[model samples]
Target chain A: MRRAIGLILLLVLAAFLVSGMLLVHPFGAPYPTDMDDYIIENAQNQTGSNSVVASVVFDYRGLDTLGEATILFTAVTGVLLLLRAQKRKEGGS
Target chain B: MLSKIVRTVANQLVLFILIFGLYVIAHGHLTPGGGFQGGAVVVSGVVMLLVAFSSQDLKKSVRERVLSIMESTGALIFAILGFAGLGTVFFYNFLVGSPIFGRIPPTGPNSGDFWTGGFIPLMNFAVGLKVIAGLSAVVLAIALFARGEEMEE
Candidate 1:
């Protein structure tokens, strides 16, 4: 009885997972565009260059990238701190 | 270890790829590929170098902290450019209009040259340096960590 219940639960979870994957949109579908479209369209006025991604990264989404860099810095600092003590332990070993 | 003939060919091919990567990085603003893509390609060459020379030989060449600092400094510079832009046009592009430490391109609005007095080119070099260093650091860390795992095994 217990084995049957477990198998039923597993089957239900597998069904849900397969259905979720199948519901994803395919390529070439007309998706709704976001604020990035308008930004790219007007990037010429702002940066005087044809590179839209550069305009977006350096000018428009600058603050977001700044925050991301800060996060990377913190993570690296943490790794260094963790490894520093490990080196000391290894030296004693 | 690769055979002698294969190793020689790989080494020559890697050098050529590295040169092409450098060209892509240097002419990023005026060309198609930018720093990150070029940096990754360069780092792949570095990876090939590691594969050719082995980890024991690679230790004397690459250091960890220096690469970390390079990556962090690149981020710092990009942030500084952001702040400078904010000061002028409140998040405007190329608003600072000053000599940005290094060579500022002598192109302007009327000059029809995309290489202008903005920090784009400088930022590309910084990002290229940062990404190359960062990726090599990762490869180094993984190599070391995996060595430990192999020892355990």
Candidate 2:
């Protein structure tokens, strides 16, 4: 019974993923490109950055980058916590 | 640990890997690669070193404390840079028209400038440092723990 339920869940997830992929726009032709056009045209002038992608990532959407950095910080902290060295008892043996 | 031949090759290759990673990080604003890619590259170099040497040798050279410190410093720098733009808005490009990193380029394709992309290059460097330190520390910890487990057996 558990295996049956697991299979059903997996099938449901696959269906959702397939439907989503089917609904996505075709390659190289994204819908609602106004923002893209604007950024492409004015990124260099506004941000003074030659790389449009960099300007958008670091300047326009910088808060997202901050959040990404925070997530990385949290992950590193978790690793340190988990792998920290534990002291051995001197006389336990 | 691997043989002496593998260790020698890794030692020689590590320098080139580090230099390439630095190049990618520094030229992120003007080139294709960015901080994440460059940092991963650097971490790969560290991994190569780790694989080539014993855990004891790795511990002597690469300390967990140093990597932790580097991670913290990178995060702090990133946060400070973000908060520095609070005068106008969050993450404002204040250095765009100023002296530092304030060189505007032509619209179309041309040779890019080094002194452009206000706050971008700095952020890239910070993120790069964070990723390299964090990943290397994690791998080092895991390797050390595995070695400890072997000793217990």
- Cα deviation at B89, candidate 1, in Å, is 5.8
Instruction: Kindly list the per-residue Cα lDDT of model 2 for residues B32-91, writing each as its tens digit.
Output: 888888999999999999899987788878777788889999999988888888898878
lDDT of 1 by residue, A1-93 (tens): 999999999999999999997777765663666686777566555554445565565557756655655665566555544433243354552
Candidate chain B TM-scores, in order: 0.73, 0.94
What CAPRI class is candidate 1? incorrect
Pick the TM-score winner: 2
Please give the TM-score of chain B in predicted model 2.
0.94
Worst 10 residues of 2 chain B by lDDT: B144-153
For candidate 1, write residues B1-153 as lDDT tens digits. Answer: 567876787779988988888877765545566667788889998888778776655656766767777878877776666666665654455543544422233333233344542565666676677667767766766665566521111
lDDT of 2 at B11: 94
lDDT (C-alpha) at residue A39 in model 1:
74
Q: Which ten residues in a row have the lowest lDDT in candidate 1 chain A?
A: A81-90
